[model samples]
Target: MSAGGAHLKDEGTRRQVVLAGGAAGLISRFCVAPLDVVKIRLQLQVHSLSDPPSHGSAAGPVYKGTWSTMRAIVRQEGITGLWKGNIPAEMMYVCYGAIQFTAYRSTTEALAQLDPHRLPPSAESFISGAVGGGMATGATYPLDLLRTRFAAQGTERIYRSLGGSILEIARHEGVPGFFRGCSAAITQIVPYMGLFFATYESLRPITTQWEQLPFGTSDAAAGVVASVLAKTGVFPLDLVRKRLQVQGPTRTRYVHRNIPEYRGVLDTIGTILRTQGPRGLYRGLTVSLFKAAPASAVTMWTYEHVLRLVQEMELAAEA
Candidate 1:
Protein backbone atom coordinates (compact mmCIF):
# COMPACT_ATOMS: atom_id res chain seq x y z
CA MET A 1 0.00 0.00 0.00
CA SER A 2 1.06 3.55 -0.62
CA ALA A 3 1.97 5.75 2.36
CA GLY A 4 -1.34 7.60 2.06
CA GLY A 5 -3.20 4.31 1.87
CA ALA A 6 -1.43 3.07 4.98
CA HIS A 7 -2.30 6.26 6.82
CA LEU A 8 -5.93 5.93 5.79
CA LYS A 9 -6.00 2.31 6.90
CA ASP A 10 -4.55 3.20 10.32
CA GLU A 11 -6.97 6.05 10.78
CA GLY A 12 -9.89 3.83 9.86
CA THR A 13 -8.73 1.16 12.28
CA ARG A 14 -8.38 3.71 15.08
CA ARG A 15 -11.91 4.96 14.51
CA GLN A 16 -13.22 1.42 14.48
CA VAL A 17 -11.53 0.61 17.77
CA VAL A 18 -13.09 3.63 19.44
CA LEU A 19 -16.59 2.86 18.20
CA ALA A 20 -16.29 -0.80 19.12
CA GLY A 21 -14.96 -0.08 22.59
CA GLY A 22 -17.68 2.49 23.15
CA ALA A 23 -20.53 0.21 22.07
CA ALA A 24 -19.16 -2.60 24.20
CA GLY A 25 -18.79 -0.26 27.15
CA LEU A 26 -22.39 0.94 26.82
CA ILE A 27 -23.76 -2.59 26.68
CA SER A 28 -21.62 -3.62 29.59
CA ARG A 29 -22.75 -0.59 31.59
CA PHE A 30 -26.47 -1.38 31.16
CA CYS A 31 -25.96 -5.04 32.02
CA VAL A 32 -23.98 -4.30 35.16
CA ALA A 33 -25.65 -1.13 36.39
CA PRO A 34 -27.70 -3.04 38.95
CA LEU A 35 -24.65 -4.76 40.37
CA ASP A 36 -22.88 -1.41 40.35
CA VAL A 37 -25.74 0.00 42.41
CA VAL A 38 -25.25 -2.79 44.91
CA LYS A 39 -21.51 -2.20 45.00
CA ILE A 40 -22.01 1.48 45.70
CA ARG A 41 -24.40 0.76 48.53
CA LEU A 42 -22.01 -1.74 50.04
CA GLN A 43 -19.20 0.75 49.83
CA LEU A 44 -21.17 3.60 51.34
CA GLN A 45 -23.06 1.80 54.11
CA VAL A 46 -22.11 3.37 57.40
CA HIS A 47 -21.51 1.66 60.75
CA SER A 48 -20.93 3.72 63.82
CA LEU A 49 -17.43 3.74 65.31
CA SER A 50 -19.15 3.11 68.61
CA ASP A 51 -20.68 -0.06 67.17
CA PRO A 52 -17.36 -1.86 67.29
CA PRO A 53 -19.07 -5.20 67.69
CA SER A 54 -20.55 -4.98 64.19
CA HIS A 55 -17.53 -3.25 62.68
CA GLY A 56 -16.23 -5.15 59.67
CA SER A 57 -18.79 -7.90 60.19
CA ALA A 58 -20.01 -9.35 56.91
CA ALA A 59 -23.09 -10.60 58.72
CA GLY A 60 -25.19 -7.55 57.96
CA PRO A 61 -28.40 -7.79 55.96
CA VAL A 62 -26.91 -5.59 53.24
CA TYR A 63 -23.77 -7.69 52.86
CA LYS A 64 -25.61 -10.76 51.72
CA GLY A 65 -25.83 -12.19 48.16
CA THR A 66 -26.58 -10.14 45.02
CA TRP A 67 -30.19 -11.24 44.82
CA SER A 68 -30.73 -10.40 48.46
CA THR A 69 -29.06 -7.04 48.10
CA MET A 70 -31.14 -6.25 45.02
CA ARG A 71 -34.30 -7.30 46.77
CA ALA A 72 -33.53 -5.15 49.78
CA ILE A 73 -32.66 -2.13 47.67
CA VAL A 74 -35.83 -2.43 45.60
CA ARG A 75 -38.01 -3.07 48.63
CA GLN A 76 -36.51 -0.19 50.53
CA GLU A 77 -36.05 2.33 47.72
CA GLY A 78 -38.40 1.22 44.88
CA ILE A 79 -37.60 -0.03 41.38
CA THR A 80 -36.10 3.24 40.20
CA GLY A 81 -33.42 2.92 42.81
CA LEU A 82 -31.80 0.08 40.91
CA TRP A 83 -30.91 2.47 38.10
CA LYS A 84 -29.70 5.28 40.28
CA GLY A 85 -26.85 7.28 38.73
CA ASN A 86 -27.19 5.24 35.53
CA ILE A 87 -26.95 8.28 33.29
CA PRO A 88 -23.78 9.72 34.77
CA ALA A 89 -22.16 6.33 35.09
CA GLU A 90 -22.92 5.52 31.48
CA MET A 91 -21.71 8.90 30.28
CA MET A 92 -18.58 8.69 32.38
CA TYR A 93 -17.68 5.19 31.15
CA VAL A 94 -18.33 6.11 27.52
CA CYS A 95 -16.15 9.19 27.69
CA TYR A 96 -13.56 7.23 29.67
CA GLY A 97 -13.34 4.40 27.11
CA ALA A 98 -13.29 6.81 24.18
CA ILE A 99 -10.64 9.07 25.60
CA GLN A 100 -8.50 6.25 27.01
CA PHE A 101 -8.55 4.07 23.87
CA THR A 102 -8.15 6.97 21.44
CA ALA A 103 -5.31 8.43 23.41
CA TYR A 104 -3.67 4.99 23.78
CA ARG A 105 -3.76 4.34 20.05
CA SER A 106 -2.58 7.83 19.23
CA THR A 107 0.18 7.70 21.79
CA THR A 108 1.39 4.32 20.54
CA GLU A 109 1.52 5.63 16.99
CA ALA A 110 3.54 8.67 18.02
CA LEU A 111 5.89 6.63 20.17
CA ALA A 112 6.41 4.09 17.38
CA GLN A 113 7.68 6.91 15.18
CA LEU A 114 10.23 8.02 17.77
CA ASP A 115 11.95 4.62 18.22
CA PRO A 116 10.28 2.03 16.08
CA HIS A 117 12.65 -0.82 16.95
CA ARG A 118 13.01 -0.09 20.67
CA LEU A 119 9.35 0.58 21.38
CA PRO A 120 7.69 -2.76 20.91
CA PRO A 121 3.97 -2.83 20.21
CA SER A 122 3.30 -4.26 23.69
CA ALA A 123 5.28 -1.49 25.39
CA GLU A 124 3.57 1.16 23.32
CA SER A 125 0.17 -0.27 24.08
CA PHE A 126 0.95 -0.47 27.80
CA ILE A 127 2.23 3.08 28.04
CA SER A 128 -0.65 4.43 26.00
CA GLY A 129 -3.24 2.52 28.01
CA ALA A 130 -1.80 3.78 31.29
CA VAL A 131 -1.60 7.36 30.09
CA GLY A 132 -5.05 7.15 28.53
CA GLY A 133 -6.67 5.62 31.61
CA GLY A 134 -5.06 8.24 33.82
CA MET A 135 -6.12 11.08 31.59
CA ALA A 136 -9.66 9.77 31.16
CA THR A 137 -10.14 9.16 34.88
CA GLY A 138 -8.66 12.54 35.74
CA ALA A 139 -10.98 14.34 33.33
CA THR A 140 -14.06 12.46 34.50
CA TYR A 141 -13.25 11.88 38.20
CA PRO A 142 -15.72 14.52 39.43
CA LEU A 143 -18.54 12.93 37.48
CA ASP A 144 -17.49 9.60 38.94
CA LEU A 145 -17.92 11.02 42.42
CA LEU A 146 -21.35 12.29 41.45
CA ARG A 147 -22.36 8.91 40.08
CA THR A 148 -21.22 7.11 43.22
CA ARG A 149 -23.04 9.49 45.54
CA PHE A 150 -26.19 9.40 43.47
CA ALA A 151 -26.09 5.63 43.33
CA ALA A 152 -25.37 5.32 47.03
CA GLN A 153 -28.39 7.38 48.14
CA GLY A 154 -31.27 5.76 50.01
CA THR A 155 -34.42 5.05 48.02
CA GLU A 156 -36.32 7.83 49.72
CA ARG A 157 -33.45 10.25 49.21
CA ILE A 158 -32.75 9.48 45.58
CA TYR A 159 -32.23 12.52 43.37
CA ARG A 160 -35.01 13.47 40.95
CA SER A 161 -32.44 13.87 38.17
CA LEU A 162 -28.73 13.89 37.47
CA GLY A 163 -28.61 17.66 37.64
CA GLY A 164 -30.51 17.65 40.90
CA SER A 165 -27.97 15.29 42.42
CA ILE A 166 -25.07 17.41 41.26
CA LEU A 167 -26.63 20.57 42.62
CA GLU A 168 -27.36 18.88 45.93
CA ILE A 169 -23.77 17.66 46.25
CA ALA A 170 -22.47 21.11 45.43
CA ARG A 171 -24.80 22.83 47.85
CA HIS A 172 -24.03 20.50 50.71
CA GLU A 173 -20.31 19.89 50.15
CA GLY A 174 -19.01 22.67 47.90
CA VAL A 175 -17.26 22.35 44.53
CA PRO A 176 -14.09 20.68 45.80
CA GLY A 177 -16.17 17.94 47.34
CA PHE A 178 -16.83 16.47 43.91
CA PHE A 179 -13.19 15.34 43.80
CA ARG A 180 -13.24 13.48 47.09
CA GLY A 181 -11.60 10.28 45.91
CA CYS A 182 -9.44 11.61 43.10
CA SER A 183 -6.16 10.56 44.63
CA ALA A 184 -7.21 6.95 45.03
CA ALA A 185 -8.73 6.98 41.53
CA ILE A 186 -5.48 8.13 39.94
CA THR A 187 -3.51 5.57 41.92
CA GLN A 188 -5.85 2.81 40.83
CA ILE A 189 -5.95 3.90 37.16
CA VAL A 190 -2.20 4.07 36.67
CA PRO A 191 -1.53 0.46 37.65
CA TYR A 192 -4.89 -0.77 36.39
CA MET A 193 -4.41 0.65 32.90
CA GLY A 194 -0.80 -0.42 32.78
CA LEU A 195 -1.65 -4.02 33.63
CA PHE A 196 -4.81 -3.97 31.50
CA PHE A 197 -3.09 -2.94 28.26
CA ALA A 198 0.00 -4.97 28.94
CA THR A 199 -1.96 -8.14 29.52
CA TYR A 200 -4.32 -7.55 26.58
CA GLU A 201 -1.57 -6.79 24.12
CA SER A 202 0.58 -9.65 25.35
CA LEU A 203 -2.20 -12.17 25.00
CA ARG A 204 -3.49 -10.89 21.66
CA PRO A 205 -1.05 -12.86 19.53
CA ILE A 206 -1.68 -16.16 21.29
CA THR A 207 -5.45 -15.71 21.35
CA THR A 208 -5.57 -14.71 17.72
CA GLN A 209 -3.41 -17.55 16.49
CA TRP A 210 -4.73 -20.33 18.70
CA GLU A 211 -8.38 -19.43 18.45
CA GLN A 212 -8.17 -18.37 14.80
CA LEU A 213 -10.64 -15.71 15.79
CA PRO A 214 -11.28 -12.54 13.91
CA PHE A 215 -9.22 -9.47 14.83
CA GLY A 216 -11.91 -8.01 17.01
CA THR A 217 -12.57 -11.29 18.77
CA SER A 218 -9.00 -11.47 19.87
CA ASP A 219 -9.16 -7.88 21.09
CA ALA A 220 -12.28 -8.55 23.08
CA ALA A 221 -10.81 -11.66 24.65
CA ALA A 222 -7.80 -9.60 25.55
CA GLY A 223 -10.06 -7.04 27.20
CA VAL A 224 -11.64 -9.68 29.43
CA VAL A 225 -8.29 -10.96 30.56
CA ALA A 226 -6.88 -7.51 31.12
CA SER A 227 -9.90 -6.29 33.03
CA VAL A 228 -9.79 -9.26 35.38
CA LEU A 229 -6.13 -8.85 36.08
CA ALA A 230 -6.24 -5.12 36.48
CA LYS A 231 -9.31 -5.12 38.70
CA THR A 232 -7.89 -7.76 40.98
CA GLY A 233 -4.53 -6.06 41.14
CA VAL A 234 -5.97 -2.73 42.22
CA PHE A 235 -8.94 -3.99 44.18
CA PRO A 236 -7.83 -2.36 47.41
CA LEU A 237 -7.31 1.00 45.76
CA ASP A 238 -10.79 0.75 44.27
CA LEU A 239 -12.16 0.05 47.75
CA VAL A 240 -10.52 3.16 49.12
CA ARG A 241 -11.74 5.26 46.23
CA LYS A 242 -15.30 4.08 46.77
CA ARG A 243 -15.15 4.78 50.50
CA LEU A 244 -13.77 8.27 49.97
CA GLN A 245 -16.19 9.20 47.22
CA VAL A 246 -19.33 8.00 49.00
CA GLN A 247 -18.64 9.44 52.44
CA GLY A 248 -21.12 12.26 51.80
CA PRO A 249 -21.06 15.72 53.51
CA THR A 250 -20.63 14.79 57.12
CA ARG A 251 -17.04 13.63 56.97
CA THR A 252 -16.46 14.26 60.65
CA ARG A 253 -19.31 12.06 61.73
CA TYR A 254 -19.12 9.29 59.12
CA VAL A 255 -15.44 9.01 58.30
CA HIS A 256 -13.71 9.84 61.60
CA ARG A 257 -14.33 11.94 64.67
CA ASN A 258 -10.78 12.24 65.92
CA ILE A 259 -8.44 15.23 65.90
CA PRO A 260 -6.61 14.51 62.63
CA GLU A 261 -9.69 13.35 60.74
CA TYR A 262 -9.81 11.49 57.42
CA ARG A 263 -8.64 14.37 55.30
CA GLY A 264 -7.22 12.41 52.34
CA VAL A 265 -6.63 8.98 50.83
CA LEU A 266 -4.02 7.79 53.34
CA ASP A 267 -6.04 8.99 56.25
CA THR A 268 -9.11 7.27 54.88
CA ILE A 269 -7.25 4.00 54.46
CA GLY A 270 -5.85 4.26 57.93
CA THR A 271 -9.26 4.98 59.38
CA ILE A 272 -10.84 2.06 57.57
CA LEU A 273 -8.19 -0.29 58.88
CA ARG A 274 -8.26 0.96 62.46
CA THR A 275 -12.04 1.02 62.68
CA GLN A 276 -13.30 -1.61 60.23
CA GLY A 277 -10.23 -3.90 59.89
CA PRO A 278 -8.91 -5.57 56.73
CA ARG A 279 -12.31 -6.75 55.58
CA GLY A 280 -13.46 -3.18 55.19
CA LEU A 281 -10.91 -2.63 52.43
CA TYR A 282 -12.43 -5.46 50.42
CA ARG A 283 -16.04 -4.46 51.07
CA GLY A 284 -17.84 -5.34 47.84
CA LEU A 285 -15.37 -7.55 46.03
CA THR A 286 -17.95 -10.18 45.16
CA VAL A 287 -20.43 -7.91 43.39
CA SER A 288 -17.68 -5.82 41.88
CA LEU A 289 -16.02 -8.88 40.38
CA PHE A 290 -19.27 -10.30 39.13
CA LYS A 291 -20.22 -7.04 37.47
CA ALA A 292 -16.72 -6.32 36.19
CA ALA A 293 -15.86 -9.70 34.64
CA PRO A 294 -18.57 -9.89 32.01
CA ALA A 295 -18.75 -6.15 31.75
CA SER A 296 -15.12 -6.05 30.63
CA ALA A 297 -15.58 -9.01 28.31
CA VAL A 298 -18.61 -7.51 26.59
CA THR A 299 -17.10 -4.05 26.43
CA MET A 300 -13.94 -5.12 24.60
CA TRP A 301 -15.81 -7.53 22.36
CA THR A 302 -18.34 -4.93 21.33
CA TYR A 303 -15.71 -2.25 20.87
CA GLU A 304 -13.50 -4.37 18.63
CA HIS A 305 -16.41 -5.73 16.57
CA VAL A 306 -17.95 -2.33 16.06
CA LEU A 307 -14.61 -0.91 14.98
CA ARG A 308 -14.02 -3.77 12.55
CA LEU A 309 -17.45 -3.40 10.96
CA VAL A 310 -16.93 0.31 10.52
CA GLN A 311 -13.54 -0.26 8.96
CA GLU A 312 -14.95 -2.80 6.49
CA MET A 313 -17.72 -0.40 5.49
CA GLU A 314 -15.23 2.39 5.00
CA LEU A 315 -12.98 0.17 2.91
CA ALA A 316 -15.89 -0.89 0.72
CA ALA A 317 -16.77 2.79 0.24
CA GLU A 318 -13.22 3.57 -0.83
CA ALA A 319 -13.24 0.68 -3.30
Candidate 2:
Protein backbone atom coordinates (compact mmCIF):
# COMPACT_ATOMS: atom_id res chain seq x y z
CA MET A 1 0.00 0.00 0.00
CA SER A 2 1.06 3.58 -0.62
CA ALA A 3 2.09 5.79 2.35
CA GLY A 4 -1.15 7.78 2.19
CA GLY A 5 -3.20 4.60 1.96
CA ALA A 6 -1.31 3.14 4.92
CA HIS A 7 -1.94 6.27 6.98
CA LEU A 8 -5.63 6.18 6.18
CA LYS A 9 -5.79 2.49 7.08
CA ASP A 10 -4.10 3.12 10.39
CA GLU A 11 -6.47 5.95 11.25
CA GLY A 12 -9.44 3.85 10.23
CA THR A 13 -8.37 0.98 12.47
CA ARG A 14 -7.78 3.38 15.34
CA ARG A 15 -11.32 4.69 14.97
CA GLN A 16 -12.68 1.15 14.87
CA VAL A 17 -10.82 0.33 18.07
CA VAL A 18 -12.34 3.43 19.63
CA LEU A 19 -15.86 2.30 18.79
CA ALA A 20 -15.21 -1.25 19.94
CA GLY A 21 -13.69 -0.07 23.19
CA GLY A 22 -16.66 2.21 23.81
CA ALA A 23 -19.12 -0.60 23.28
CA ALA A 24 -17.10 -2.85 25.55
CA GLY A 25 -17.01 -0.20 28.26
CA LEU A 26 -20.76 0.34 28.06
CA ILE A 27 -21.46 -3.37 28.44
CA SER A 28 -18.96 -3.83 31.26
CA ARG A 29 -20.09 -0.76 33.18
CA PHE A 30 -23.65 -2.00 33.47
CA CYS A 31 -22.51 -5.49 34.39
CA VAL A 32 -20.38 -4.28 37.30
CA ALA A 33 -22.00 -0.97 38.20
CA PRO A 34 -23.66 -2.23 41.39
CA LEU A 35 -20.38 -3.52 42.65
CA ASP A 36 -18.87 -0.20 41.71
CA VAL A 37 -21.44 1.61 43.88
CA VAL A 38 -20.75 -0.70 46.77
CA LYS A 39 -17.00 -0.28 46.41
CA ILE A 40 -17.18 3.48 46.51
CA ARG A 41 -19.45 3.37 49.53
CA LEU A 42 -17.02 1.11 51.27
CA GLN A 43 -14.09 3.29 50.33
CA LEU A 44 -15.78 6.48 51.49
CA GLN A 45 -16.60 5.17 54.95
CA VAL A 46 -14.85 7.35 57.51
CA HIS A 47 -14.42 5.42 60.73
CA SER A 48 -14.36 7.58 63.84
CA LEU A 49 -11.04 7.80 65.68
CA SER A 50 -12.69 7.93 69.12
CA ASP A 51 -12.34 4.74 71.19
CA PRO A 52 -16.11 4.74 71.75
CA PRO A 53 -16.42 6.20 68.23
CA SER A 54 -17.87 9.31 69.89
CA HIS A 55 -17.31 11.87 67.18
CA GLY A 56 -20.96 12.93 67.79
CA SER A 57 -21.66 12.15 64.14
CA ALA A 58 -24.05 9.27 63.55
CA ALA A 59 -21.92 6.18 63.23
CA GLY A 60 -21.90 5.05 59.64
CA PRO A 61 -23.25 1.56 59.20
CA VAL A 62 -20.45 -0.93 58.79
CA TYR A 63 -20.64 -3.02 55.64
CA LYS A 64 -19.54 -6.53 56.45
CA GLY A 65 -19.00 -7.44 52.82
CA THR A 66 -20.37 -7.19 49.28
CA TRP A 67 -23.67 -8.90 50.08
CA SER A 68 -24.30 -6.73 53.14
CA THR A 69 -23.41 -3.58 51.26
CA MET A 70 -25.83 -4.58 48.48
CA ARG A 71 -28.52 -5.23 51.05
CA ALA A 72 -27.89 -1.93 52.78
CA ILE A 73 -28.04 0.03 49.55
CA VAL A 74 -31.19 -1.70 48.38
CA ARG A 75 -32.85 -1.22 51.76
CA GLN A 76 -31.84 2.41 52.20
CA GLU A 77 -31.93 3.83 48.68
CA GLY A 78 -33.89 1.18 46.77
CA ILE A 79 -32.62 -0.67 43.71
CA THR A 80 -31.78 2.66 42.10
CA GLY A 81 -28.98 3.05 44.62
CA LEU A 82 -27.15 0.23 42.93
CA TRP A 83 -26.94 2.43 39.85
CA LYS A 84 -26.23 5.76 41.46
CA GLY A 85 -24.23 8.03 39.18
CA ASN A 86 -24.57 5.45 36.41
CA ILE A 87 -24.89 8.12 33.76
CA PRO A 88 -21.58 9.76 34.57
CA ALA A 89 -19.97 6.38 35.15
CA GLU A 90 -21.14 5.15 31.76
CA MET A 91 -19.95 8.33 30.06
CA MET A 92 -16.58 8.17 31.74
CA TYR A 93 -16.23 4.48 30.87
CA VAL A 94 -17.08 4.95 27.22
CA CYS A 95 -14.75 7.90 26.81
CA TYR A 96 -11.98 6.38 28.88
CA GLY A 97 -12.12 3.01 27.13
CA ALA A 98 -12.42 4.43 23.61
CA ILE A 99 -9.56 6.89 24.04
CA GLN A 100 -7.41 4.32 25.80
CA PHE A 101 -7.77 1.58 23.18
CA THR A 102 -7.46 4.02 20.30
CA ALA A 103 -4.28 5.57 21.63
CA TYR A 104 -2.87 2.22 22.71
CA ARG A 105 -3.57 0.62 19.34
CA SER A 106 -2.22 3.56 17.38
CA THR A 107 0.97 3.81 19.43
CA THR A 108 1.61 0.08 19.40
CA GLU A 109 0.98 -0.18 15.67
CA ALA A 110 3.25 2.75 14.96
CA LEU A 111 6.05 1.35 17.09
CA ALA A 112 5.71 -2.08 15.50
CA GLN A 113 5.73 -0.59 12.02
CA LEU A 114 8.81 1.47 12.81
CA ASP A 115 10.89 -1.33 14.36
CA PRO A 116 9.21 -4.69 13.89
CA HIS A 117 12.38 -6.61 14.69
CA ARG A 118 13.30 -4.91 17.98
CA LEU A 119 10.59 -4.48 20.62
CA PRO A 120 8.53 -7.40 21.89
CA PRO A 121 4.75 -7.46 22.16
CA SER A 122 4.74 -7.25 25.99
CA ALA A 123 7.00 -4.18 26.05
CA GLU A 124 4.98 -2.55 23.29
CA SER A 125 1.71 -3.22 25.12
CA PHE A 126 3.11 -1.84 28.38
CA ILE A 127 4.34 1.38 26.80
CA SER A 128 1.19 1.91 24.76
CA GLY A 129 -1.12 1.08 27.68
CA ALA A 130 0.72 3.44 30.04
CA VAL A 131 0.60 6.36 27.63
CA GLY A 132 -2.93 5.62 26.56
CA GLY A 133 -4.17 5.22 30.16
CA GLY A 134 -2.66 8.59 31.13
CA MET A 135 -4.29 10.20 28.10
CA ALA A 136 -7.64 8.58 28.78
CA THR A 137 -7.60 9.60 32.46
CA GLY A 138 -6.61 13.16 31.64
CA ALA A 139 -9.16 13.52 28.86
CA THR A 140 -12.09 12.15 30.86
CA TYR A 141 -11.05 13.09 34.40
CA PRO A 142 -13.85 15.55 35.09
CA LEU A 143 -16.44 12.97 34.26
CA ASP A 144 -14.60 10.52 36.52
CA LEU A 145 -14.60 12.97 39.40
CA LEU A 146 -18.28 13.64 38.90
CA ARG A 147 -19.04 9.95 38.80
CA THR A 148 -17.19 9.33 42.05
CA ARG A 149 -19.01 12.15 43.79
CA PHE A 150 -22.40 11.04 42.54
CA ALA A 151 -21.85 7.45 43.59
CA ALA A 152 -20.66 8.52 47.00
CA GLN A 153 -23.66 10.78 47.50
CA GLY A 154 -26.33 8.04 47.66
CA THR A 155 -29.70 9.21 49.18
CA GLU A 156 -28.14 11.94 51.31
CA ARG A 157 -27.08 13.87 48.25
CA ILE A 158 -24.56 16.58 48.82
CA TYR A 159 -25.50 18.35 45.59
CA ARG A 160 -29.14 17.09 45.33
CA SER A 161 -28.81 15.91 41.71
CA LEU A 162 -26.46 15.63 38.72
CA GLY A 163 -27.10 19.07 37.23
CA GLY A 164 -26.96 20.54 40.71
CA SER A 165 -23.69 18.77 41.41
CA ILE A 166 -22.12 20.01 38.20
CA LEU A 167 -23.22 23.59 38.69
CA GLU A 168 -22.33 23.61 42.36
CA ILE A 169 -18.84 22.29 41.72
CA ALA A 170 -18.28 24.75 38.89
CA ARG A 171 -19.54 27.68 40.97
CA HIS A 172 -17.81 26.77 44.20
CA GLU A 173 -14.65 24.87 43.43
CA GLY A 174 -14.00 26.25 39.92
CA VAL A 175 -12.59 24.34 36.94
CA PRO A 176 -9.86 22.59 38.87
CA GLY A 177 -12.52 20.97 41.06
CA PHE A 178 -13.32 18.73 38.15
CA PHE A 179 -9.71 17.55 38.24
CA ARG A 180 -9.18 17.40 41.99
CA GLY A 181 -7.28 14.12 41.91
CA CYS A 182 -5.71 14.30 38.46
CA SER A 183 -2.25 13.35 39.68
CA ALA A 184 -3.52 10.51 41.84
CA ALA A 185 -5.79 9.27 39.07
CA ILE A 186 -2.93 9.25 36.59
CA THR A 187 -0.72 7.50 39.13
CA GLN A 188 -3.40 4.87 39.78
CA ILE A 189 -4.53 4.25 36.18
CA VAL A 190 -1.35 4.50 34.08
CA PRO A 191 0.75 1.85 35.79
CA TYR A 192 -2.28 -0.31 36.50
CA MET A 193 -3.23 -0.37 32.82
CA GLY A 194 0.38 -0.80 31.72
CA LEU A 195 0.86 -3.76 34.01
CA PHE A 196 -2.52 -5.22 33.07
CA PHE A 197 -1.85 -5.06 29.33
CA ALA A 198 1.73 -6.27 29.67
CA THR A 199 0.54 -9.16 31.83
CA TYR A 200 -2.13 -10.01 29.27
CA GLU A 201 0.42 -10.01 26.47
CA SER A 202 2.80 -12.09 28.51
CA LEU A 203 0.10 -14.65 29.32
CA ARG A 204 -1.03 -15.13 25.72
CA PRO A 205 1.54 -17.75 24.88
CA ILE A 206 1.15 -19.54 28.20
CA THR A 207 -2.66 -19.63 28.03
CA THR A 208 -2.81 -20.78 24.43
CA GLN A 209 -0.27 -23.52 25.09
CA TRP A 210 -2.19 -24.81 28.12
CA GLU A 211 -5.46 -25.36 26.28
CA GLN A 212 -7.14 -24.52 23.03
CA LEU A 213 -9.46 -21.55 23.64
CA PRO A 214 -11.62 -19.18 21.68
CA PHE A 215 -10.24 -15.74 20.83
CA GLY A 216 -12.00 -13.74 23.51
CA THR A 217 -11.80 -16.38 26.22
CA SER A 218 -8.03 -16.16 26.46
CA ASP A 219 -8.29 -12.42 26.56
CA ALA A 220 -10.85 -12.68 29.36
CA ALA A 221 -8.63 -14.98 31.35
CA ALA A 222 -5.65 -12.72 30.91
CA GLY A 223 -7.71 -9.69 31.84
CA VAL A 224 -8.88 -11.33 35.09
CA VAL A 225 -5.36 -12.25 36.09
CA ALA A 226 -4.00 -8.87 35.19
CA SER A 227 -6.81 -7.03 36.98
CA VAL A 228 -6.32 -8.94 40.23
CA LEU A 229 -2.59 -8.33 40.32
CA ALA A 230 -2.79 -4.70 39.22
CA LYS A 231 -5.68 -3.84 41.52
CA THR A 232 -4.04 -5.39 44.54
CA GLY A 233 -0.86 -3.43 44.04
CA VAL A 234 -2.62 -0.10 43.45
CA PHE A 235 -5.75 -0.14 45.65
CA PRO A 236 -4.29 2.48 47.98
CA LEU A 237 -3.83 4.98 45.16
CA ASP A 238 -7.40 4.43 44.02
CA LEU A 239 -8.71 4.99 47.57
CA VAL A 240 -6.80 8.23 47.77
CA ARG A 241 -8.11 9.30 44.36
CA LYS A 242 -11.71 8.73 45.44
CA ARG A 243 -11.20 10.74 48.65
CA LEU A 244 -9.70 13.63 46.73
CA GLN A 245 -12.59 13.71 44.26
CA VAL A 246 -15.23 13.82 47.00
CA GLN A 247 -13.35 16.60 48.80
CA GLY A 248 -14.28 19.14 46.14
CA PRO A 249 -18.09 19.04 46.31
CA THR A 250 -18.40 18.15 49.99
CA ARG A 251 -16.16 20.79 51.58
CA THR A 252 -17.93 23.34 53.81
CA ARG A 253 -17.13 26.87 54.98
CA TYR A 254 -18.03 26.12 58.61
CA VAL A 255 -15.91 22.99 58.82
CA HIS A 256 -13.48 21.53 56.28
CA ARG A 257 -14.94 18.13 55.53
CA ASN A 258 -13.46 15.25 53.45
CA ILE A 259 -10.59 14.22 55.68
CA PRO A 260 -8.03 16.89 56.44
CA GLU A 261 -8.34 18.69 53.12
CA TYR A 262 -6.05 16.54 50.98
CA ARG A 263 -3.21 18.77 49.71
CA GLY A 264 -1.98 16.32 47.07
CA VAL A 265 -1.39 12.65 46.28
CA LEU A 266 1.35 12.17 48.88
CA ASP A 267 -0.49 14.13 51.52
CA THR A 268 -3.61 12.06 50.95
CA ILE A 269 -1.52 8.91 51.17
CA GLY A 270 0.20 9.95 54.38
CA THR A 271 -2.99 11.18 55.99
CA ILE A 272 -4.81 7.96 55.28
CA LEU A 273 -1.92 5.94 56.67
CA ARG A 274 -1.26 8.08 59.72
CA THR A 275 -4.87 8.64 60.77
CA GLN A 276 -6.92 5.81 59.36
CA GLY A 277 -4.15 3.21 59.56
CA PRO A 278 -2.80 1.04 56.74
CA ARG A 279 -6.14 -0.74 56.56
CA GLY A 280 -7.73 2.58 55.69
CA LEU A 281 -5.98 2.62 52.34
CA TYR A 282 -7.54 -0.73 51.56
CA ARG A 283 -11.03 0.09 52.79
CA GLY A 284 -12.89 -1.11 49.71
CA LEU A 285 -10.28 -3.57 48.53
CA THR A 286 -12.70 -6.48 48.86
CA VAL A 287 -15.47 -5.02 46.74
CA SER A 288 -12.99 -3.60 44.28
CA LEU A 289 -11.43 -7.00 43.71
CA PHE A 290 -14.83 -8.58 43.25
CA LYS A 291 -15.76 -5.88 40.76
CA ALA A 292 -12.43 -6.06 38.97
CA ALA A 293 -12.51 -9.75 38.09
CA PRO A 294 -15.81 -10.02 36.25
CA ALA A 295 -15.70 -6.43 35.04
CA SER A 296 -12.26 -6.89 33.51
CA ALA A 297 -13.31 -10.20 31.98
CA VAL A 298 -16.39 -8.69 30.36
CA THR A 299 -14.52 -5.63 29.15
CA MET A 300 -11.61 -7.50 27.62
CA TRP A 301 -13.75 -10.22 26.09
CA THR A 302 -16.18 -7.76 24.53
CA TYR A 303 -13.38 -5.46 23.44
CA GLU A 304 -11.48 -8.23 21.68
CA HIS A 305 -14.61 -9.54 19.98
CA VAL A 306 -15.75 -6.11 18.88
CA LEU A 307 -12.25 -5.27 17.67
CA ARG A 308 -12.18 -8.44 15.58
CA LEU A 309 -15.63 -7.67 14.20
CA VAL A 310 -14.48 -4.16 13.28
CA GLN A 311 -11.34 -5.49 11.58
CA GLU A 312 -13.39 -7.96 9.55
CA MET A 313 -15.85 -5.27 8.54
CA GLU A 314 -13.04 -2.93 7.54
CA LEU A 315 -11.31 -5.63 5.49
CA ALA A 316 -14.59 -6.46 3.72
CA ALA A 317 -15.11 -2.78 2.88
CA GLU A 318 -11.57 -2.48 1.52
CA ALA A 319 -11.99 -5.59 -0.56
- lDDT, model 2: 0.79
lDDT of 2 by residue, 1-319 (tens): 6432232223356678888899989999999999998888777766632234323243533455678779977987899989988998899899989998888887777776754364666677788889989999999998888888777764566756678878998999999889888899898988899998888778755665756676538878888999999899989999888878877537432111334577889998888888778988998898899999999999988987888788888889999
Task: Give the Cα-based TM-score of candidate 1 against the true structure.
Answer: 0.83
**Backbone clash tally for model 2?**
0
lDDT of 1 by residue, 1-319 (tens): 5332232125356667677657766788888899898877666544422333332243332335567678877887788778888899899888887787788777776775673244655666678788989999998898798777677666345467778878887898888788988989999998889888888778766777756665447766777778887888788788788777766554333211221235678887888888778777777777888877778777777766677778889889999
The 10-residue segment of model 2 with minimum total lDDT is 251-260
Cα-based TM-score, every candidate: 0.83, 0.87
Candidate 2 residue runs with Cα over 4 Å from true position? 1-12, 48-57, 113-117, 209-216, 249-260, 314-319
Model 1 residue 9 distance off true place after TM-score fit, in angstroms: 11
Q: Best by TM-score, which number?
A: 2
